[model samples]
Target: MRTLIFATAIRILTPLFLVFSLYILLRGHNHPGGGFIGGLMGSIAFVFHTLAHGTKQTAKSYFSLTFYKYDRKPHHNNLSHALRLLRKNIVRNKKEKPIFIWNYYLLRLRPTYLMAIGLAVAVGSGLVGLVMGKPFMAAYWLKVKIPLVGSVGTPLLFDTGVYLLVLGMVLKMVFTMSKD
Candidate 1:
């Protein structure tokens, strides 16, 4: 079902798509493109990969490069381990409670947290203006010189948050629906 030509093309274009996504995200604050558009562009690249390769292969490749490792084999769940440890500790000592470890394996691989974070950031940005006795989402800019990009503003942060939120939501939906 996989096409070699399409896979090769996707491999070549993935980096370009990522870079272009960043460009769109950065330019979005002042121009037409921002986080939502940038996120969609990035997601398209992944979708292209998923189409070229199978979903499992694409996810394995992507996760391997990132923090999470996508393992097909069934294994012990983190919550179960935590619960077992908690029970053991409770029986061993009444004074000390079981401490939940936050290791890499215990790390969240879901987009829900990302969505929450994005919502918080967007809300915080709006709240900043409110705290300053201004209307919500009032544009605030800081004039500064950079090597490539010129001036920046609070709108960029809001845009970035929006981008993350959209990206997470899209990825979550795609992965959830595609799962076997």
Candidate 2:
């Protein structure tokens, strides 16, 4: 389903989507839009990009940008190189003389990590209220003022957690389905 029009639109619209999502996330407390909605909006950019290009191409351009290619040599096994080899997938053509290896060491921005960190942030936000002798998940505001977001609070943190969780979940699903 790759179309020239769609690809062009994606390239132009991706940044807009991300910026709008952030805006929604930051203005969530007073306005209608919040972390969950913001997260969905944010994930849509990448999902649309994936649809426009493809899984492999999107991953190569974004996720797995840095990779290594190597030929099958016996003596290339050093400590750091061996560690890299463990995460490599060897791709070969018909003759198989020149093997292409994709190393995953540089792909630190994984969806699972986002999910875990989001969950932790959400829970920790609730725990903050508990530690202050308030009920769990209660709102607790800090006495500082920020420019865009204004007062910092537990609700904002919880919203952020929801945003990350939703973004990661949707991206994970998109990536998983794209693989098939």
Candidate 3:
């Protein structure tokens, strides 16, 4: 049932998102965007994918999110939020009932698990460095000193770990939530 027009449009747009995301992440090294924003942008591809195919099929593209995982209680907390967020714009803008708002707020994690992972990674990396005997958990500086940023120090490793953790979790979250 795929229309030629829809297929052509998606084909053109997916690569566009990927290219733009790469630019943002690379340029972000000194300016604004970075791997974190890049990850979210790249993740939007799957959201668009979900729109093209149904959720069950789209789920295949998100490797980490197993469809069967929801079988234990189908209506798990995160799953509920995922469905709600995905359907929000479609329903609300279509003049649907407002009651769904209540469900949205109720199931949505206050800070979301993505944020939690970032925090944990940062803290854990820093703590581990301290135990390693480098004062202030020297991450980059412990190894070598750069120019303007001072010794990269433990903060850099902590920051890097957190950055990676945040990006991975956010990308996964956005994809899973975009299900149709």
Quick one: best lDDT, which candidate?
2
Error of 1 at 117 (Å): 2.5
Compose the digit string of candidate 3's lDDT tens values, residues 1-180.
Answer: 357777567667877987776665555545433656765776566556556764555444443342222232445458776687578755676556553322111122222455676677667766765787765544544556566444544455455444555555654665567544
Put down candidate 1 lDDT per residue, 48-161, tens digits, no spaces. 777777667766776443344544224446788658767787677767654543333433445676688878887887887888899998878776756555667778878878
Overall lDDT per candidate, in order of appearance: 0.75, 0.82, 0.56
Answer with 1 or 3, whichever has the higher TM-score: 1
The TM-score that candidate 3 achieves is 0.42
Which residue pairs show backbone clashes in model 2? Answer: none
RMSD of each: 11.0, 8.3, 15.8
Model 3 misplaced stretches (Cα beyond 4 Å): 1-3, 62-180
lDDT per residue, candidate 2, 145-166, as tens digits?
9997899898899989989999
Model number with the top TM-score: 2
